[model samples]
Target: MKNIIGAKLKAYRAKNGVSQFDLALKSKGKLSTSTTSTAETVTNYDPRLSTFIEMYRYVDTPFDELLTEMGYGESYQSTWYKRHKGNS
Candidate 1:
């Protein structure tokens, strides 16, 4: 895998004018500058579930839009919600 999520996150960061440092700061220890950089540039990056959530949440990226862009259909989205709901 080529880290599709990270690429989309980079695009979102650029679109929203948010720097890595800013994202890390905004995350309040949920994220870090190094982690953000690695996520954007590392081909083998495997981020945690919370990392994915916080990154997208920081840039206000819509979950449905991201899933669609990543080639996951609406079915998977609903399945994900069903499985993960109330866990957090």
Candidate 2:
């Protein structure tokens, strides 16, 4: 499957004139250059959930939108919610 999340991340950064290095910097150690790089360039990489959360928050995208864009159905959504809901 295509890495839609990565593509969206790249697009968000590009649209906002933010470089990967700057992204990491702006994140203030919540994210790293290597992490951003792998997410953007690694075709088959499945990033951790926290990474997704951080990136989504950083780019001001809604979590529901992210899950939807990833093509996850209701089951996955409920599971993800159950696992991460109160933890947020």
Candidate 3:
């Protein structure tokens, strides 16, 4: 899951043509400086919900899009239904 979130963050940053440092700067004002720093600190960290929301605000991307872009397959809200759809 952390890897998925990291992949999404990296993809979004790439799509926007921004470096991690640039993202950190942008995120600082919208999210928290610590959150931004944590994101930039490693390549595989699960982002907090607030972090995703803040990133979406700054990048004009939806959380679902981000999740898809990161290869999450289904939205978090639909995970259980998606998982159990075939079983039921």
lDDT of each: 0.75, 0.75, 0.61
**Model 3 lDDT per residue over 1-88, tens place:** 5444544555677788977667767766565546655665666767767766665565545655656666675645476766675584
The TM-scores of all predictions, comma-separated, are 0.67, 0.73, 0.45
Model 2 agreement with the true structure over 5-40: per-residue lDDT tens digits: 777778888899998888888888777888888888
Q: Count the backbone clashes (under 3 Å) in each candidate.
A: 0, 0, 0
In candidate 1, position 36 carries an lDDT of 87
Better of 2 and 3 by lDDT: 2
For candidate 2, list the clashing residue pairs, or say none.
none
Q: List the residue pairs that clash in candidate 3.
A: none
TM-score of 3: 0.45
Error of 3 at 2 (Å): 5.4
Candidate 1 stretches with Cα past 4 Å from truth are: 75-88
